[model samples]
Target: MLDFTKSSAPAFQNLTPAQFAEGRQQPGAVLLDVRRPDEFAAGHLPGAFNLDVTASDFGPRVAALDKTRPTYVYCRSGARSASAAGQLATAGFAQVANLLGGVLDWPGALTTK
Candidate 1:
């Protein structure tokens, strides 16, 4: 029952495709694609960093990021990224945003792999 949504400045927010696109434009945004490497190789948002949420190294990789930064995460259709977003929130990321519909509902063209 850590209600991140109740905070005045919520630590975690599930965003619509539009909100996600706009928010990631802010300076210092960290975009994380929490999908398999092959899935990422197929296509992803520009500047996305690939890191498998299911991979054994997921925890370590996530730890390498600056916890105080604004972190946005996505997967093919949201499920995986939602989990990752929760993890990010629990791990003390200052701002953790999950793309609601993932890449399937992305507002812009994915970078060709």
Candidate 2:
């Protein structure tokens, strides 16, 4: 769970499953599944880009994305994507959001493609 009272709260948004689902439908949404490739292959959010947060090229890969766009990230759970969201915020991303509870909380939102 995210502490909305924290100073970092303004740095990015921590969205609940419902909010995540709604927000992701907006135009120019950039959803990133920050999980390992194998995990991503099993299932992931439709249209999400799989980028392992633990990989050596993670920074460079994310760097190529448009920082001004609204970026939403998640993992199996919320942990790893929280780290990735922090990195994105620090990298000057104008709009960053993390999917609270991640994909585990959205059983109906995943697709195995």
Local distance difference test scores for all models: 0.91, 0.90
TM-score of each: 0.88, 0.89
Model 2 gets an lDDT of: 0.90
For residues 1-113, write the lDDT of model 1, one tens digit per residue: 67775754335899999999899999999999999999999999999999999999999889889998899999999999999998888777899999998999987899955
Cα displacement (Å) at residue 113, model 1: 5.2
Question: Candidate 1: deviation at residue 10, Å?
Answer: 9.2
Compose the digit string of candidate 2's lDDT tens values, residues 1-113: 97766675338788998898888888998999999999999999999989999999999998999998999999988999999999999988998889999888985657887
Per-residue error for 108 in candidate 1, Å, reads: 1.3
Best by TM-score: 2
Model 1: ten consecutive residues of lowest lDDT: 2-11
